[model samples]
Target: MRKREIVLRWHTIGLVRTGSTNYLIHLEAGNAFLEAANLSLSQKSKHDAATHYVNASLVFKKDDPKKSIQCLTKAIEIYTGKHISATSTLWIGPFLSITYTTLYTTKFSRVIFLVLHLEMGRFTIAAKHHMTIAEICEKDLVDIEQAIRHYEQAADYYKGEESSSSAMKCQLAVAQLASQLGQCDKAANLFEEAGKASMENNLLKYGAKGHLFKAAICHFCVDLINGQKALKTYEECYPMFADSRECALMKKLSEALEQENVEAFTTAVQEYDNITRLEPWITSLLLKLKKTISEEEDIT
Candidate 1:
């Protein structure tokens, strides 16, 4: 009867959804689960309690972020086995398991926790969490702006930790998004920094040319003179960049942009596309670049 009651409580907790008026009920159930876990010292019960904490946090997120954070912190502590008594985790037997209301309950709770941490100026511990949120935004939610925001924040934190490789990865993600949004100057600077950093790492040096090429393209969107200057600087920094097909393509596109020649740019892009596939993102940026040149010609 006691075990059946426990399972019913777990089921009741799982049924509560976000923004539902059952906030207090879920919180009480979560506390009861924790108490049961402590009394019985069951690992699975602890896990159930942690999951309940996460769901409860989500329920109160908008109304009371502090309380939400408190609940999420408890959930994380339980998940990581911190502060809980070691003996309380003894796996006696699987009694009951409650499926999460949302598949992303844990991930969402962590993201919310770190975002609040960021708002409160606690950046030191947010690097990994921010990166995780960034990936979730990019891959799961398909929110490019949020992904860029989180990636940029992660880059800053990574730089503080002296994790240059990780920071460069974030920079690359932001740069790609910036270029897609036609924020050419921001993209150009980030790509240039990432390229320079890549050139310094023996393992990443081969990929440096691709970064430089993208940077040069972003600069082209800003101005032909800037593009020419950037391409020259890239070649000087990495001699191998000058010998690459990307370098040849950039030179052709730069010449076209300088003369406001749309046909030449289109032909160059087509020739390159025929030899090597240009991904949709690259194709989109190229179209934007071509439009800029066309707009300039129309003005002339």
Candidate 2:
């Protein structure tokens, strides 16, 4: 009876091992089927094409333009019915157009046509086509001012669409460009408008930068005007700097105005003393002040 019990125990162990192996095999097959199903779905949705193009774009951004172009081409072909999504060609169309434009040479007909139109002074037409190109290229380009202008034109063209943000960005770009051109008044106005728009949009940084630019305009205007009002403007707009020459000059001017001492004021004038020296009108005023001070000293 003991021998029979030992044999039964061995048989039970063998049966348990077989069951464990079968269970593992079933799990492995299930995982394989799941992977195959995922691949089928990816192919059906043309998601693989999107993935390839997006990865290639990333590679291009990382400085491997040639490899990136190759990857993009493969992706374009994959999406264009070579391997996936044969019945539909939606996702790859815009991406291919963008890639083709990026890779276009001067010899390319479209680029040549664009150049000819631009050279012929067809600015409006050229701008329209350039906008198309920019839309395709999207974040692949920089030139903030150019992008802003393109978006502005696009917003105008698509008037029915909501483009308040685009308009505000365009205004900001215009303000920045005007500031660079030293058109302080126009820049200040645009900045103010941008600040208002940004505040409405809950864009804190944009509003702050706008206020900063407005302050800068005030500072520049004050320097040009040179009076008590200008002095007050400078004080109001004083930015954090290690040492600001403009602030120093303003302080010196204010001190000289307060002291009523001709020699001290003249000596305090640094490099900008020429401004006071060359101006006959300012020199006459200074002489009058000096004479008045001298008379006061004499009476004392």
Candidate 3:
């Protein structure tokens, strides 16, 4: 081994052993690892460098999270081939967990490593992997937009695998985020797709009612014409929904919005809520639909 590589390794080991007590030492050790990574003769050395960077990050985590994330990003870029910014609210925990756990265990780690580096032809595994990462972004980090992108990727892979149920599962998650983001048209289309898919499955047919109901509401947010058209289509596809309370509420709200009658819209929602409690997400979207009528009335 070269004199520089040997020196860098010794420096890294010494600094890391003493770095825990001194933040500056920790930072210096990180810098040394980065330098070693650049001069390293093998992938193993580079991997060790990345691991050391992660250790340095933990030391900076409490006092300066941004610096910690920058270190983590540097470590990630070594493996992921791109630098992730600290400004983005994405939790890097998933990436770090995969790195640490896989490297330490060396079990299924090789499979994932092959998948990442080689881009192996394992669509189902890749799809499921991305889905897990997407869930972490959504549920833990609350980064809905990032989660949507991952879910879309997972859905595409699932489709390629001819896994209808799994694809719809991902699509449904994206639809929920779209509704929250006020992308009414996208949400409506995705929900409609989910409803159709669910109706085709005996075990999931009951969920079709909920999906169709959300679809109509999303279409309503777009406009009354689209809402009415969607309602008719949903009713034709699933006759059970036509007789349901949710469908009746949608019809009542449609009439109320068409006439710009705020009282009628409020009454319809109140009556529905009294019978079956609406989830907060549903209630929020309903308010947005109501806003359209209120705005139109103001204009007229």
In the range 131-238, model 3's lDDT, one tens digit per residue, is 765776677567889889979988998898788889998999999898898898999999998888788888998888899999999999888899999998988879
Ranking, lDDT, top scorer first: 3, 1, 2
Tell me the tens digit of each residue's lDDT in model 2 across 1-300: 453344334333433333333545433333332233234334453433334343333324334333333444444334333322223233322123223334343367775565434323322332333344343334444344554455455445333234466545545555554444455566556665554445455555334443433434333433334344544553554342103544454456456545655566565543545543434433343344345546656787
Candidate 1 wrongly placed segments (more than 4 Å): 1-125, 139-142
lDDT of 2 at 212: 38
- The runs of at least 3 residues in candidate 3 whose Cα sits more than 4 Å from the true structure, single-residue gaps closed, are 1-121
Task: Give me the candidate number with maximum lDDT.
Answer: 3
Between candidates 1 and 2, which one is better according to TM-score?
1
- In candidate 1 the C-alpha lDDT for residue 250 amounts to 94
Candidate 1 per-residue lDDT over residues 66-164, each given as its tens digit? 455466556545533433232332221245222233322446666545433433333334555566556666765677787799789888877876778
Candidate 2 residues lying further than 4 Å off, grouped into runs, are: 1-57, 64-160, 163-170, 181-186, 198-300
lDDT of 3: 0.73
TM-score for each predicted model, relative to the true structure? 0.61, 0.28, 0.61
Q: Quantify all predictions' global Cα lDDT against the true fold.
A: 0.70, 0.42, 0.73
